[model samples]
Target: MQQPPSHAREILRLAVPAFGALIAEPLFLLADSAIVGHLGVAQLAGVGLASAVLHTAVGLMVFLAYSTTPAVARAMGHGQLGKALAAGRDGVWLALLLGIVLAVAGFWAAEPLVALMGAEGDVRSFAVDYLRWSMPGLVAMLLIFAGTGVLRGLQDTRTPLLVATAGFALNVVPNLWLVYGLGWSVAGSAAGTSVAQWAMASVYLVMVQRNAARHGISLWPDWSGIRAMTRVGSWLMLRTLSLRIAILATVFVVTGQGAVNLAAHQLAMTIFSFLAFALDALAIAAQALIGKELGASNSVRARQLTGTMIRWGAGFGVVTGTLLAVAAPWAGALFTSDAGVQSVLTYALWILAAGQPIAGYVFVLDGVLIGAGDAKYLALAGVANLAAYVPMLVAVA
Candidate 1:
């Protein structure tokens, strides 16, 4: 039997790199917010609304990565590398297919969607441009999600860390040049990000292809496998949608509070999101490790791993919460110069920090259940959770 400390070490090994990869997504958004913010309040608000909608849409599809990761890891644990690679290939095909459907729909619906969200005047115009230009990026984003799953399942978190780091680094120059030098404004932010997403997707596709060939797995779509994944993913999608609904509900309430409150909420949400990725790194590690253990029929070991991971999650939450509390004052200044917005943000940050422990536990358990192939239960629980959350939000509002 492995020592308890060994489990901690294993979790850290996977988590450290997963942290880098996961954090990149939010960091990119933070960059967009910071840069677009300089254009004025309306531009910043437009980008925020567009981004919120985009996140909700793509967020539901994240099951592509979550479902694929555990399935591939399980297959690998059974010593079926070829089978695992084939399963992963099906996920990639599904991602590509779904991405195209979403892109078309999103482009067509951009203006109406922005209107539906209650934007008007310059805010509406800027949001329409940002939302439409961002659709192509969705395709690449979905592909990357599926590809990351394959790599993570193959027990190679380092690849995603390296790719995401490079992608983020490359994103900065183009974004600055297009937004400032070329004067594309909000549209430039979307275009620069779209280019980076596609580059990352291309690299992942090549890597996946090479690995498939090495394992003698066919690159062709496996309809049966894809169907199975979709069935599982549908439930996961519901789970994700439930969470997004909660977010949108919160945003809706905040928006009613006035412009300063809305701006503060966006800033606070961005920071909370970035911090979440840190906590989520441990959850990602749990998915890969727990799935592999369960696949090997080591239920006892799987239980042990889950227990250890939960503790790690709690520890991380404590550290993050402390840091967030300490940095709240300075952090607000980094994102904006508005004193009113800064004051509102400072208040929100404290509330977020207070939820860290619960958030950590919930996130880790969510990942563990997914690894155990309990997507249906997770989906049902998501609805119940949302039901509970709405009333609280309403009361607060």
Candidate 2:
């Protein structure tokens, strides 16, 4: 019997690197906000509005990673490495196809979408610019999602950590140079991030290709496999869609409060995302490990892993929440200099911090169920959650 300490080590082995990789995703936005913040309130407010739409789009597609991870992990656990690779390949193909469609639509509809969010004046103009420029990266982002899913399925979080770190560096320098050095404004920020995303996608594609070649898996799209992937992903997508709708609703409400409030909300949301991703690292670990365990028919071990991870998630939340609370007063200064935005953000951070424990628990359980391939229930529950949440949100609005 593996001791409890062994379980902790296993979770940490994946979770630690997963933490770094996960946080880097949000760091992209964090960096964007920090750099764009210094431009001016209108600029900052514009990017904020654009990012809400962008994040919602990306969030809805997260099932690419969510679905592929468990399928690949399960197949690998069952000793079907080739099949696992095949699943990953299908995911990439699906990502590419979906990316193209979304990019085209998003590019053409950027103005309408931003307008729909109630943005106006320079904020609307900047948002439209940012959204249109960001279209190119949509495909790359989805590819990265699928590729990261493949690697996670293969129990290779380290590669993602390395790639994401490099990608972050790649994103920041160009953004700084382009936005400041060349005066590209929000467009430059979007362009730089897009380029970095593509670079990251390329690396993932190469790695996936190499693995498929090594395992003698065909790189060609298998329609049946892709169909199957889509079927599973549909449920997960619904679940994700619900979550995105919630966030988007929140953003819409904030946007109506004026640019200053919207800008503050954006910074606060960005920071919240950073912390959420940090906490989700444990969930990522659970997804990988639990899927493998269940695939191997090791229910007992899966249960044990779940218990350990939940505790870790809660504890990690407590620690992070405390730190966030302590830093709340000054954290806004790191992203923006506007005193009004900073003050609003400080209050938001405190509220966010207080909810950390509950969020941590929910995130972990969500991952556990996802890893177990309980998408149908998750989807239904997600709808239920949204139903329950909308009223509260409306009340606040």
Candidate 3:
């Protein structure tokens, strides 16, 4: 699919930094595997299981970003700089609230949750320790995630990506020291990742403030505007939580089956994540563009933006998914040397990659809906799918 007339260049403008920033995200995961991978499959497997659970829980609060992005963009589009800045402040408040709640729960429940994943012995100990040390990162991750959303909404993906890239680069050195030099095991990896996230979050916040100031937006919160954010954010929070739960449930069920299966699924998932997240960046671009277009009161432009995003998503699916399908063996090697894991991961990657075009449509359609502030449907759609995904996973297994 050709871009929307220089569309490719325009999209790349947002996507490049975004992709670079997001590269750190995969590094965060790959680092997790690299650390635990050396510890033995059992340890790797246990952290993998716990990480899935922890991410879902953190995802629950990520509504801060999913909800805030389009809104901020709309305000910016309408030339309501004050309102846009207010959105930023309220976002920090709401994200921190959700973060604090998640942090306390994650720390307290890390042990029991890892145990429930069926992890045992030293593996369980490693998972618990990793979670305990890594819980702080969840807050930072959410905040940074939401902050990125705000910036992207304004059609400024470059800054977030730059911040992400810097943080990701800084992470490698400390990780090497902790994992190989000091032999701190999985905890070292977790610590390294946590520190990296902290750096990213701080950079994002600073960048947003500077951008707002330069753009003449008030850098403080407005109570009245915050109420509007609340109204919009409520539906978003639910929608994000539902999506998070659905993915979480996928991990949960896979774990219940066994460690080998769970590890395979995780490896497949990590590989699939590259395509999914990359496509999401396209969705992010669409959300930023369409919402701002709508806020400019040009529904026609908004609809056009939506159409382009869907087209780009399909094109992206074909290109990126094909690459992943071809590279399945290499991805498996990156995770582990287990023959069972390699086989399962290889098969699962094909299944997921084949579905990318379909999944791509769903994700981009989601961006369209969210951009319109029609996120109620996103939540409802997931709830509606509970029956289908649950039964399908069981039947497929």
Candidate 4:
């Protein structure tokens, strides 16, 4: 009999492409920041503030992906392709419903949300504009999340990488033309990103539809399946919400400091997000692989995979942290020309760099547990984490 591939090999198979796809998601923000940063400090700060709100909203819905991935993977492991496709379809439908509601709410609440973030004057105006214009893309983003989850559960990360890369490339030109050429300012950047997001979502929908048809799965939304998804997702959402709250609180504090500090925080946060996603590739692998292993009732393989991934996560973190630390001073210049913002950003980047190893270890274990369908424990852990973090945040404030 032929021997199976090594655990590391299996992880890299998924992780390499996952890394590309994962980073591409954040590249959307990075691209926006790079493009919008040149407009002026106020513009960058405004986008930064708006993004925190946008990210918080979308982050809450991440269970669409997280819940779907393992559910589908488990079904597949049980040799139920139709059931897996059915589960994925429900995730897509749920995404659509939530996306529409969120888009409307986001559009209407744009100003209030920006104000709540402590934005004012030109920053407030710019933030509201970006937030409202970006609403359409919010729907697309959730769809992408669901669709990407479907593919990941099916053990195919390459397609997402392709779609995301194309979307990123598609995003740049329009943003440039709209912001500089048409002089639409922050609104233009938001519009361009929204357009690209829709395009990517379209591709994912087409693929999902094709798969469903091939598997003889109905395209209609199964309310029952969606309910099941949400049931599992609630715990995951709570887990995710805790993390978002931490991030939002950080932004809230920084926003109070002044435009320069807020702008610097945004740049540092964007870089931090970029690195976080890069590290999360291994986590993504863990989710898919561990879920499948557990579904197949192979706890031994699951545990082995978990150990290997943890090591990889830590090692990858060290390398990324070192690079980030080395790049801290110069990295700020890439986003903005403002000397004050650049100086503050350098300090933030150094701090972020120092935390990467811990972040990496946490991310992988989170994925491992998530893959195991241990959502309740994760949710409880999230609360504890938030409780611990809040005091530190208060001290900083």
lDDT per residue as tens, model 1, 241-339: 999999988877776666677777778888888999878998899889989998899998899989888887887788888888888877777777788
Q: Which stretches of candidate 2 lie over 4 Å from their true place?
A: 1-3
Report per-prediction Cα RMSD to one decimal. 1.5, 1.2, 2.4, 1.8
Model 3 has how many clashing residue pairs?
0
lDDT of 4 by residue, 1-397 (tens): 2224687689988999999999886898999999999999999999999999999999999999999999888887888889999999999999999999999999999999898888899999999999999999999999999999999999898899999899999999999999999999999999999999999999999999999999899999999899989999999899889989999999999988999999999988889889999999988998999999988999988988898889878988999999999999999889999999999998989999999988889889988988999989999999999999999999989
Worst 10 residues of 3 by lDDT: 1-10
Per-residue lDDT of candidate 2, residues 332-395 (tens digit): 8898889999999999999999999888988999889999999899999999999999999999
Query: Distance from true position, residue 173, model 4, in Å?
Result: 0.5
Local distance difference test values of all predictions, in order: 0.88, 0.93, 0.76, 0.92
lDDT for 248 (candidate 3): 70
Candidate closer to the true structure by lDDT (higher is better), 1 or 4: 4
The collision pairs in model 2 are: none
Comparing 1 and 3 on TM-score, the stronger one: 1
